[model samples]
Target: MNNLPIGFYVDNLYCFPVGPSGSQRFCYLPTTPRIEVLGNEVKARILNSDDAAVLALQIVWEADTDTIEKAKSEIKNRYPELSFINLSLADFRGVTATLNINKNDKVIYSIGPINTSGPDMFRAAFQDTLKSAEKEAVLNAFNTGESGVITIVYDGYLKLNEIADAEFDGDLATEIKALAPREVEEKGKGFFSKKHKILTPSPSLQECKDAVGKAIENKSLIIQHKDSANVSKKAKDTVIQEIINDISQCVFTKIEEVGKNSQYISSYCCRIKKTKAESVKFNLKKSYDLVGTISESRGRDIIEK
Candidate 1:
């Protein structure tokens, strides 16, 4: 029978007791990976090599070595705290002897660095060793435990798709062109001087929705004209208005929580477009106030909300 199965090797180097800290408050100190556990030690799972390094640093910021060496030491110090029973390549002796193994053979472990430049140089070397020892048919031989030279080869590939259909047709294009803006004469600067208006702040979310419903009911212009093609540009403008109306009709709920306090606010806007929606979401909670302006062209206005 094989001496080892599908399980990880564990080593405990150091540990300490901690209290009252968030995210598991315990501190253990060990210089190396495999120190014997004492009877009065804290309870935790084993740590994988990478996790061991991380945990060691979490417990104490400094390790007694440079990058790679520090990583190894940290791993050694905390390997016993991990829960998974993965076999360690470091613990296995014949791991170096038989480098040939099938990729699908269900090897007990995978080993790699925290980061690698380009392809991992260590993994590349390891793969080369496996190819040399296995020869070919690595997977089949590994699955059956057959006594023969095995070879494993893996091919990587990618796929792409080309666009086939265009959604904008002749009618849609003609309508869209009609919606383009035409310049009009500028308004007199003193036009609003006689009328003094109070700048009231926007209402809460519920009030905003009620106001939007009232405005839409009053406009009576939600539907686009089918025969608007005679005035192609006008028809396109109507379509754009329809799109804005559809967007404004959709309601979004907002909830904000601060420490022990929580509040819900609902709001709506009349002029909703793709660009405006993006800007609103991007600047949310920062700029809550809105303003409006009229266009020189007839029946054209821009509202920022």
Candidate 2:
């Protein structure tokens, strides 16, 4: 499992179902999100860089004790909680909020992803481990009250598609792309207008993706040229990234190993190619400080563009 070394700022990590209907389940406000949740999420804690460091250590310590000791030695001094209140109330645009953890996990959980590959869907399941005092405190808060005041910071792997290539992401996508040859069972198919529409194409998943790319490029939404339909670079580029984002999330949802266990796609930090729908592998220098502060608003301003 590859641990992702990047972060995204969520305005409020507490947007669950308001009632037992289980119908309404998504929200993304660019400003202070006014969600109407019942008695929960008030315990949410807005994290600072140091607080993030603590959580990171909790994750790392479970894997390597030496690394945790070294990390603890070098982490920044704890700061006041007043510093990161801005993140708890942000308006991140276009990230799919459909990923979910285990049902047993007391933390936030979303719906399982749609995988056309087979009847079996890959859901995130964590091994049982006793939480340390510090780790317990953080989870107690992360799982508790987060209605609309606290932002979420996840430390995980970037999607193989987000890394742009198999080489950059240790052939993560290459492995998945290879799985294309396997036989799949037709399940999880949905219908509209009383017609069945399989989310994952039966035998042409890659072919369908390629065709989509070509169609999007050829018939762009915003036609730049009056005579040409595929002339708008802006709309094409924007939609292309969105497509990549969807594929990446699909990778995250369907392929449990490709998520935090692989690498993280920074919608807030990294940039996708304006001309191509795919992203490329990052040749990030192996530095502790670079990993020390994984803020999405590092190079970019915290204020929304």
Candidate 3:
């Protein structure tokens, strides 16, 4: 009987350099072939340790098992950073690859090594991998037709770009006034009085209003749902409250209230604010977020910087 057409499995691939600085010699570690091929199952192990850079990857396939061994072998030889050991074939359903890395280590899988060369090359390679993975994910999702709602909390502060684009309430007004400058005047001999001047258009207030209004207008629940009225009133209430909480938590990062339009600042701020706001909007509208984040920025410092 012919050996089952099995894919290749690489146990561990490692790269370490030797010789003097700037004239270093490097090659794969001396060890058992870290790669293995089993009927439909391929496995490999790899390690990346470089003074300046390192990478480790394990590639596997679910189709065309017969070509996996050849494919892996070719790839390994071309990329010295890769290693293939324990050449064997067996009966299995899938292949596996693993890399040993520190908790803080960042790993990237690319068609080629990233060098002093501009990210252009790396980006192209990265894109190919991403496209492949994305295609697979989208296909899987489409085939499974599985989706649901997810609720996310967003909280942060933003500066006013223009004024009055979004409505403002007392709570919002208070937060804005707290961040403004105060004027001092002398009253005769030793007595002095201070008056507070409203220097900028407070967009935070409007942000709150816009955020809440948007949720209401879209009939979106902060808690997240998939176009379902099956949600209990309590759940619905929770979602609304969470939306409010997120808006209220936002702090104005920058205030550009000088333009005659007054709205210019508010509009500009909203655009930037969307990074975090969009997540809330997504949860409210689609019942789930395919992308986005809700964490608030540290403060206005990031914006001003």
Candidate 2 error regions (>4 Å): 1-122, 135-139, 146-279, 282-305
TM-score of 3: 0.18
Whole-model Cα lDDT of every candidate shown, in order: 0.24, 0.26, 0.27
Q: Over the stretch 183-292, how does candidate 2's per-residue lDDT look in tens digits? A: 33453446533433333322234543453345336652112211111123454456455654544444444334332222333221222332323322222111111111
Q: Ten residues in a row with the worst lDDT in model 1?
A: 283-292
- Which candidate would rank higher by lDDT, 1 or 2? 2
TM-score of each model, paired residue for residue = 0.16, 0.14, 0.18
Please give the distance, in angstroms, between residue 25's alpha carbon in candidate 2 and its true position after superposition.
Answer: 29
lDDT winner: 3
Query: For model 3, how does the per-residue alpha-carbon lDDT over 81-182 read when each residue is reduced to its tens digit?
Result: 535333222222111122211112222222322221121111111112123333333223223432211111111111111111112222233333443333
Candidate 3 lDDT score at position 121: 14
In candidate 2 the C-alpha lDDT for residue 225 amounts to: 16
lDDT of 1 by residue, 1-305 (tens): 11211122223222221211111222222222111123633111222231121111001111222333443444445545533222111211111111223335443322221221111111112222123222233322323434322221211111111111111111112211222223334544695745443322223444434443454456532322222101234434544544534433332121111211111222222333221110000110110000001112210111001
